[model samples]
Target chain A: MTSRDVLFAAVGLITAAAAVLAVTNRRVLHAGLWLVVSLGGLAGCYLVLGAELVALVQLLVYVGAVVVLVLFALMLTRSGGGEVDTSPAHRWLAAGVGAGMTVLLGGALVAAYGWDTREVAGPGNEHIGEEIFGTWVWPFELLSLLLLAALVTAVAVATTGHSRDRAA
Target chain B: MDLPLAVEIILKAVVVLAAFLTLPLAIGQTEHKVMAHMQGRLGPMEAGPHGIAQLVADGIKFVQKEDVTPASADRWVFKLAPAVALIPYLVALAAIPWSAAWVAADVPASLLLVLAVTSVGVFGTLMAGWGSGNKYSLVGGMRAGAQLVSYELPMVLAAASVAMAAGSLSLTGIAQAWSWWWLIWQLPGALVFLVAAVAELQRVPFDSPLADSEVVFGPYTEYTGLRFAFFLLAEYAGIVVMSLLFTVLFLGGWSGPWSDTLGPLWTLLKAALVAILILWLRIAWPRVREDQLQRLAWLVLLPLALVQLALTGVGVVVWG
Candidate 1:
């Protein structure tokens, strides 16, 4: 394998390990941190694949925002001292299912694509803008609307009746 | 005779070394002098004119001081945290286009790369807070995380407006397109971006994580000596970077009144002006309450950014 391929494989291994750690880590906060590592590794994989935009979005959204919010929620819940039960029963069964699914998906991907090398097309930024605003404008707008709704919901949940609590 | 790769590497090394050594000192001196003036004092009149060497003295003191690690801290992550906090700010300088051809690496998505690297700086704060095993540090780190996340969206949205207006992700390309400058057309977006930038750097009014009275130095409460100095340097570097970026992306970059004549000097002048403003804000403002900070971001800035984005989109379609 080429050096790039080796790098990709290494990144994939790191990502998988981090994912496992995230799921199995005892501390909720530590697990959340591991989730950052896993997601960050996945972003690195995307970077290796030459998807800079996707990689950056992954870093920005997952590392910068989502995991942070998760940590905030963890802290706000006031469960800092509790021992988290990370281990789940039927671990062998779950691993078996995961391995099977991975194999099946890998088989489907290999069969469908057949090692056909395609040129990566023109500059990504222009293409992304065109794709986003031209053919996918409706969905793009819909996503924004949904995000607005989610923001409203978050604010409502965070602020409602808390103003009174502040004075108390 | 053709120069070897090593020679080029040496030249680049010299440039970076010069910058790393000199820029921080200059910026630090400027901050102290500005802070002194704002506080109605003479401000660092010794060590050199305007106390120019005050930062150097501070640096020496920091180096000579005792470096202590709290007993309760996680040794590995605690040690790693300050370096983590500082390195991203240095890496970010690589992507900031100083002039038309003066970028360290002219990557296709330089802006995004800078944002990604700087985002990792937050992890340093988070790890420092958590690993320190101090409640105050934990709270500080948590506050930093929340503030960074909330402000980041509005910051990204503000950047997107510029990207849409300029039709490029390259910082230099964006700067080159500023016939009228995006700041003039996207004033509201620029304002939102400035505020978010301050919050990202955890500066005044938004510096809840470091609120002395509230959190007692927050994440860095457990850090001492040079390790703590690194965090302070990183914060200042962040301010410098954010101001430079604001100059490059929106404020006509190096294109000033005398841009045709004074190329990089013009850019430096503009960036320095903005940096001065940031320093002034830092000294003049008081720390905002955490909840008020969040409310200002989500309730006010986010909607303003969204509107700015919408306006930019419409303007682009109509004018481009």
Candidate 2:
């Protein structure tokens, strides 16, 4: 096998393992930390595949901001230290569902792609920019609007409570 | 004559790593003497000639001290936190163009890589805070995470403005495409970026996260000896990286006279000046209250960043 293939396999394996660990960690804070590792390993996979832009964006948004925010909220709520208590029945159910989903997805992928290695399309900033602005512009802008609405609603919610407290 | 790819890569890594290790000490020395002079006192006269080896002494002292871990702390995370805090700045440094051709790694989107890795550095502080199992550390980490989240917006926007102007995301490309007039045009965004950078670095005036007065050194309260030194090193390294980045983004990087031969020197000189300015800021302003800090970032810097972005778009459309 080629070096690139081996590298990709290694990164993919690490990402998968980290993903599993993230889900299985008993402490919520440690789970969050594992999620960071999982996301970071996924970025490494993207980098191995030469999708530098996507990889960096993933690291930036997911591992950097999202996980940090998750950890922050956990710490703020003082829940970072405690181990999550899960019933044995619920744990078994979660494992079964997770395993089933994995099998289903793996079977579907194997059926579709078979053994062929598809050629990667352009992977850099230029092409990604075109794809987003050119083809996906509408959905992208719509998403922005949705986010803007969410942002405004959040501000209103946050401020209105503070103002009520001040008046009280 | 071309060198082997592996050798070239190794050499570049060595140089970057050297800078990563040494630049922080230099900056730390600058902070010592400059802050001392600024405060009308001798900073480190006893270490070596003019106290130049003060950081060296500090380094030795730190190395010799007992590395203590709090009994209640998470062992693995506590041990790992300092490295996490320190590595991102080193990675970011590899992407910054010391001159048009001097960057260690010319990643296509180096700016994005730099910003991404630096953002990841916040996890280090958060880890230290939580892992320390100290109330002060947790509170400090919370403030740091919140402040970083708040300031990250304007910082990214301001950097995005630079990228939009240059029409390239590469740090080298940005430097090459830079012209004199951008200094005037990008001033507001530059200010926002500078402010955001200070907050990100947990420096003076924007240092509520590490406010020793209230939080007892914040996430670092539980840290001792070498671990504390590592965190301190990370902060100094952060200052150098951010200052160098600011020089590249806003100033005409290596663009003045004799640029061809003196390009890297010009970049380093400008970056040093910026570092001095950052140090000077320590004495210039008091620590901003956390509320005021958030208000400045969200209400002032964010709007200014948005407006600057719009202006940049207009400028590009009009001038292109």
Candidate 3:
């Protein structure tokens, strides 16, 4: 394998391992930090694949903002110190569903693309921008609207009882 | 005569790391003397002639002092946090445009790279506080993270406006685009950027995270010896980085009447002026309350930044 391929493989393995660790970690704070490691590894994979802008965005949004948000919520709520138990029934159900989905998806991917040797298109900043604004404009706009609605709902929920006290 | 690219990069990285290691001495001493003069005190007068060797003496002391950790502190995280805090500044130093042809890396997205790497330092500060196992340190880390999040919005928005104006994301490109000093044209954006930059550095009036009066040096309280020294050095290095960024983004970087012949001198002069200005603010202002800091960032600076971005976008379309 080429050096680039080796690098990608290494990063992908790191991402998968971190993800698994994040799910199984006992302490909530440790789990959150493992998720950061997983996200950071995914960003490294993107960088190795020559998607610099996407890699940067992943680092900025996921590693910087999302991880901090998770940690902040954990700390602020005083829930960072607890150890969560995994019951046998829940573990068995999760394992069954996960294995089934992985098998189905892996089989479908091999059937569809195993015969092809064509190179995949690497998406750069300009290409991604054009695709989003041209072909996927409606979906992009709808997603933004959904996020806005979520934000407004959060604000409303937070202030529901505060106005009465303020008025008094 | 050509060196391999890997070798070239390693050499450059070593040079940048050496510079990062030594910069705090000169800069820290200058800050001490400047603040001392302002407050009518002699700072570090006994270390050497006019305290010239004060930082060197301080460095020796840091190395010789016994390393100590609290009984409750997490050993590994406590050890790793200072390196995390300091490495980003060292890495970002590689991409800085000291002058034309002087930067170690002139990547197309150097500006974004610098911002992204430097933002990770917040994680370091957070880890330091959390690993200390002190309630005060944890609260300090939380405040640091919140402050970083609040200020980063306006800082990025202000930078985006500059990128729009210059049509490039590289610091060297930004410097080359400004035939006239950019400060005059983008004064509003520059002002917003400077304010947000101070908040980003957690300087006075925006230093609730490290407020000695409230939290006892915040994250550094549980630290001792070389570890505390690293945190202090990181803060000084941050001041230097921000000063260089302000010079590059707003003051027309490296471009003076004689820059063609003088080269990096112009850039150094402008950056020094910015650094002194930041020190002036530290001496002049008192610390603001945490609530006021958050309110000013969200309620005031964010809106101003958005307006500046819109104006710059319009100017680029109409005037360019």
- Residue pairs in clash, model 3: none
Give the CAPRI class of candidate 3.
medium
TM-score of chain B of each: 0.95, 0.99, 0.96
Model 2: CA > 4 A from native: A159-168
Q: Please name the candidate that would achieve the greatest TM-score relative to the true structure.
A: 2
lDDT of 3 by residue, A55-155 (tens): 87788788877788778777677677688998999999998998899999999998988965545445876677689989999999999999999999999
lDDT of 2: 0.93
Q: What lDDT tens digits, residue by residue, belong to model 1 across residues B223-288?
A: 888998999888878877888889888887888776666777877888888888888888778888
* Model 2 chain B: ten consecutive residues of lowest lDDT: B98-107
- Superposed by TM-score, candidate 1 places the C-alpha of residue B187 at a distance from the truth, in angstroms, of 1.3
Q: How displaced is residue B6 in candidate 1, in Å?
A: 6.5
Kindly list the per-residue Cα lDDT of model 1 for residues A19-131, writing each as its tens digit. Answer: 99987667777788789889999998987777788888798778877787777777667454346853456677788898999999999988998777554433476687788
What value does the lDDT take at residue B288 in candidate 3?
85
Q: How many residue pairs clash in each candidate?
A: 0, 0, 0
For model 3, what is the C-alpha lDDT against the true structure?
A: 0.84
**lDDT per residue, candidate 3, B105-137, as tens digits?**
777777777787778788778778777878888
TM-score of each: 0.89, 0.97, 0.94
The TM-score, computed over Cα atoms with residue i paired to residue i, of candidate 2 is 0.97
Task: List, residue by residue over A47-99, the lDDT tens digit for candidate 2.
Answer: 88889999999999998889989999999999988988889999999999999
